[model samples]
Target: MLYRGSCHCGKVAFEFKARLTGVVRCNCSICSRKGALLCAVPHESLTVLAWADDLSTYTFGNHAIAHRFCRTCGIHPFAEDVREGSERSAYINLNCVEGIDISVLSIFDFDGRSA
Candidate 1:
């Protein structure tokens, strides 16, 4: 299935193709604070549709993931694993996605705080 998403102000828009089996909820400090329901997709499957240059990034701890957000709205729409040696992946914030009811999806808990 193809999914479209964007930040609250629509400044950061993107789309991706995925047959989402489930979504993830992580307990790490940042993830916990953001309260995003994330769905992992291959980096290649994601396309930035608009205002790519306007997006802001945030990283912390090991700094493997680059959390991308809209500067104007402060909404984190997605994040990517940028560590050179790691398998590339984009974690899409399902809350930002359009035309879907997240309540129907199974959510897996990730103990990111311990990782």
Candidate 2:
């Protein structure tokens, strides 16, 4: 499946191709605080469409997952695997996805605070 997503303002948009492998809910500081619904996709299936330069990145802890947010809206649209040599996967913010029915999606809980 091809998923379309964007920031709150919709200035920055992207498309990813993947059959929803998994949705992760983390109890980590950032995720818990933001209440984000995360969905994972392989590295090759994801693509950024427009205004990528307008996005900003934030890292914490060992920074295994590089969180990317929109500079203007401050909404986290997608995450990338910029962890040095790891190109395993990318966890996208399901909250930013558009025109998709997520009612049937299954979610997994994780403790990323210790990762």
Candidate 3:
């Protein structure tokens, strides 16, 4: 399935092919603060439709995940992680997805604080 998403101000928009297997809830400082529900997909499966100069990146700790956000609205639309010995991953913030009812999806908790 192809899902479309955008930031709060629509400064950044993207689409990806993914079936929402499960939503991920992370306990890390950033994740907890954002209260984001993320859906993981292959990096190659994502396509930025309207992103131009409106995207900004933030990284912390080991800088493994590149948290991408809309500079204008400060909404984190998605995050990209490139891990060693593994395929690159794109975690889309389900909150930004169009016509998604998160309450219907299975949720999984990730203990990112311990990592």
Candidate 4:
């Protein structure tokens, strides 16, 4: 199913077409601190509705992934271009998705958040 999610201020909106197959919690510094649950989707299946200029990008460590968020609401909705070999993958934030019964979704723990 496709899910529509937006920032708190509505300045940023996006849709991703995919099943809520599972969620991955990365132990990486930022993700661990932010408590973001990564929702997987085909990169091309995502649509950004508005405010590219209002979106801010953050990168660290290897600088491979560009984590995008709404500068107005400070919500990290998803991330793009995480791995160079598989640029077709983008991770969305399940926390921002509505109408989803997250308790039913399988959750995977990634080692990134640990150290």
Best by lDDT: 3
Model 1: per-residue Cα lDDT over 1-115, one tens digit each: 9999999988899999999888999999998999999999889889988764779899999889999989899999999989664469999999999998988899999999999
Candidate 4 stretches with Cα past 4 Å from truth are 82-86, 113-115
Q: Which lDDT values do the candidates have, in the order given?
A: 0.92, 0.82, 0.93, 0.83
What are the per-residue Cα lDDT tens digits for candidate 2 across 22-110?
A: 67899999888877888878877778776657888898887777888888889888888775554678878888998766667788999
TM-score winner between 3 and 4, please give it: 3
Looking at candidate 1, the ten consecutive residues that score lowest on lDDT are: 79-88
Error of 1 at 114 (Å): 0.1
TM-score per candidate, chains pooled: 0.94, 0.87, 0.94, 0.89
Model 1's C-alpha root-mean-square deviation from the true structure amounts to 1.4
- Give the lDDT of residue 53 in candidate 1: 74
Q: Candidate 3's residue-wise lDDT over 1-115, tens digit each?
A: 9999999989899999998878999999999999999998999999998777899899999999999999899999999995764599999999999999999899999999998
Whichever of 1 and 3 has more lDDT, that candidate is 3
* Candidate 3 C-alpha RMSD relative to the actual structure: 1.4
Clashing pairs in 2: none
For model 3 the TM-score comes to 0.94
